[model samples]
Target: MAGSQGPLVLGPMLRYIGETDATVWVETAEPGVVTVKADGREWRAPTFSVMGHHYALVVVDGLAPGDELPYAVRFGDVVVWPLADSRFPPPRIRTIDRSRPTRLLFGSCRTSVPHDREGNSSNGVDALRALALALADGEEAWPDVVAFLGDQVYADATSEAMRDFIAERRDITQPPGEEIKDYEEYAHLYGLAWSDEAIRWLLSTLPSCMIFDDHDIRDDWNTSWTWQEEINQTSWWHERLMGGLSAYWVYQHLGNLPPAELARDEVYAQVLAAGSGDGAEGSGIDLTEPVFDLSRRVDRHPEVYRWSYRRELGDCRLVVVDSRAARVLDPDRRSMLDPDEMAWLDEQLTGDVEHLFIGTSLPFLLPPGLHDFEAIDEVLAQGAHGRLVAAAAERARQTIDLEHWAAFNEGFAEVFDMVIDVARGNRGRAPSTVLFLSGDVHNSYVAEVTDAAARHGAQSRIVQAVCSPIRNPMPRVVRVLMSAFARSLVRPMHFIAARSRRVPDPAFPWLVTDGPWFDNCLAEATIQGPDVAIVWRGGEVRDGDDLHPVLTTVGAVRIPGGLDDGARAGESAADGRPTVAR
Candidate 1:
């Protein structure tokens, strides 16, 4: 068995499993009897794989509601602890608070460069790392949970460490060498990606939930069916997907769901109900086997299984949409979520909670200019822009390089309807805030949603808060152009599209009333009391031993409960929206 080396990485962490007893899972480097001790009880999940990515799920049941308890894990004779750089103070515990409204820290598009401590010139601090540091330093209070929106790892955008690891494991001179192309390589990539100190500690200490974006597989994946077809024809496409999806299952997906849910899952049930918990003759399960067989079937027929995950925290319910794999690729009927998945999303959006947080890797609402550009290009895809422009647009789509909800109108409409219905109180009490947290565009901003109050009058309510690139920053030129384009052109196009399509566009011609810029940043929102406030803070940039994780205020927007009524009556308060000073 391989001995543990480096810092014990305890993350993609999660906190506050809500009123229900929590179930924890981890993949160990060496399997020597792993046990999770919490709530004064210990549960053991025997090791099943020799590769050291041991999957163990411990169910911490029968706990009192709204109680915070410290917990720890043990591996054989050695005690496996959360990293020293943990964000929240170390006793590695869970707080089960139901009365306090949940505070969720969410953002995505983070890259894992070597931490500065290793003498490796790194990209600034990880946004999650900064948040962790803040929590540890008491600069910021701990959130009830952290939801990692997407792109946790870029299989296509591999790092030096990832490339080197792949080189040692397999002969790269072979057809798909030097980069990850299959299940075996993907498994190795995950191991390299998560082996970090700050992140490990963060994951171990916080209860994090995650979903996948394009980079999680490849950039701009599933923009259209044409893109899917083009990628499928590539020499290394099959292996790449197999590795990507398989690793996702082991590293991310399994941990997001409750043990009971997993047990009920057909695939996981086979693994659990297996007699010896090993790949025995009559055991009926083997997790180490290539996930290609399973992933391929799902890709071919997305309706067969759904990878989306959901959880309820007190009065708030979070629905994480699986935008990539579950897409409907048919030419005539294209959408982000297929019918079944959409129905599942609709069901989850019903009136059981005070707030609904929909986590999609791509923002449902993008900069208006970008949205229009995509809409125009999509029209070109259908042969509207003569031949040359149409061909060029189609090429871009085939290469997987488009963004915006219009690319998948079917799915966009479904989500839009969900938002509208929820806002209109069709789904229980309209959440105090129907907030969307997203990351793919690489720049972060927040926008509020408004509907025509009097059969065509602008009345706003829905809000979108975006945080991106926990490390990766966009090029200066691209950023300038995007900012200008969004400010000038995009806003008008949204209104035009709404009118031309005869769809009820609830969006107002909004500006970046907050920010259109920021370096790698993490976003946090608190739903405590009757008020909701969302804030974004940039990450720290270090030079030598001088760590500068400055918390620059990007923008803070507050949604007051009575403001909607005031706005409707034309009784405008400060800044026109009913917001109290933060």
Candidate 2:
């Protein structure tokens, strides 16, 4: 590797990886020639500027599948990797081998704080940092890929350090000053989130993907048409929405695309056309105006833009949905996914695989009791009773996030039927395990759904595995409130709520078999030939020179296939066994 590159401002983060192609993203103090060298090949790309921020994505191609390669990042004559790499067995990444089963690591809601005494005491421990420490200590096995479910950063909940930076630059006395105001602020937020030594190394060597939740933009963003109407009236919301979505594109979403898809990106092509003369110092046609407009257009008309994507891993298919931006918030016809988005999801739901993983930031299947409560709230909020009742319900709904899948009954039914068809082998050959990997609601738990309909040969085990609050826990009061709410949904209340819609019973009934663990945690999903097992683990800081994060198992469950249509859930252990559905 060359000499130390002028201190990397952000990442050597490994992004998308195909059988023969890979993408690496980075940010530096000032833009310069960025290069990646590995497997006896070299790839060079120049950084582009957006509102004075410099970024580069170097795509390496022509690599064989399962190729084990040591890669280095160089900015001009400075080596930005190798020395900064992790001191573990597999320091470099090995490309994906399509023949192997998919092992995915996932979680959400992480706060970026220092890994020292003061930081830990203030914000608790960051599970992401903990995972990084586990990797540093050789205490965890590397997975094939990582998925950040959502809320990767909280624009509404700024830390003291973030506030301090905001105060230093602009007037803290002004409106919308405490929270993030624009793309520049978002860049700083991402820098704080990704700059830690251990996590940086882990990200540099792992293939990763991400989606944004409410907090990533602002609390209760796009929750309802009413909420949208209110927010749009605010003076600062327009700029804030543009900033949040645009920053997401540049930071998280852009890297998720493969080489062909990235080339097809209209904005990327536009930027390239305007940036032909730039020599990595960001001396080209400015991109601020066009990029910002593009972002705004995406929010204004999400149907014109496509943010959802699907990828096939070995015999398993991974579908990551954009549950936020692509929403239809009509009061009479609210849906988490618009019709176009639903069509896209319908196309992706077909199965001829052993395992199918659906990644949504919000859990599709919450506890049956909790799901009933949200559905009831939505009905009341939609004027099922009266205007006054509707008004009160709306307040409660927004206050407590009664805007998940169950709240959007139409959308929920669509999703349920899609999964049911795939499970029943209506699309293609039925998959063995239909797993929904999600993280939201600030706790970890898993539930399993048993289809009541007749099965086609092999019945799929539908399950929802939730891991949340990688660093952010619900405040004690909120936790108590949620618990009380979950417990108070007795049989009579839930029955009344479910009957209010006069709809037929669900295709499957599910149960929470594992936990609602409220600790900073990460989760792993292991898929065998026809079985899928998931485990949630919390992070405990161990005493040492470095704040070492020790992983502790919170809960684990295995959902197996090969069950007959008449088969029932088996009595088994909480770790990796089947449990009866509610």
Model 2 lDDT per residue over 380-454, tens place: 888878999999989998898888888888888889889888877888888887889999889888776643333
Worst 10 residues of 1 by lDDT: 573-582
Which regions of candidate 2 are displaced past 4 Å? 1-7, 84-91, 271-285, 451-458, 480-490, 502-507, 544-546, 569-582
Q: Could you tell me the lDDT of residue 368 within candidate 1?
A: 59
**Over the stretch 319-415, how does candidate 1's per-residue lDDT look in tens digits?**
8889888887776776888889989998887654666788888888776566666666676675654788767888876554564665776678778
**In model 1, which regions exceed 4 Å deviation?**
1-3, 6-16, 30-32, 50-52, 82-89, 117-122, 171-177, 275-285, 398-400, 451-460, 491-512, 546-552, 562-582
User: Best TM-score goes to which candidate?
Assistant: 2
- Report lDDT per candidate: 0.65, 0.78
Model 2 residue pairs with clashes: 3-79, 556-575
RMSD of each: 4.4, 3.3
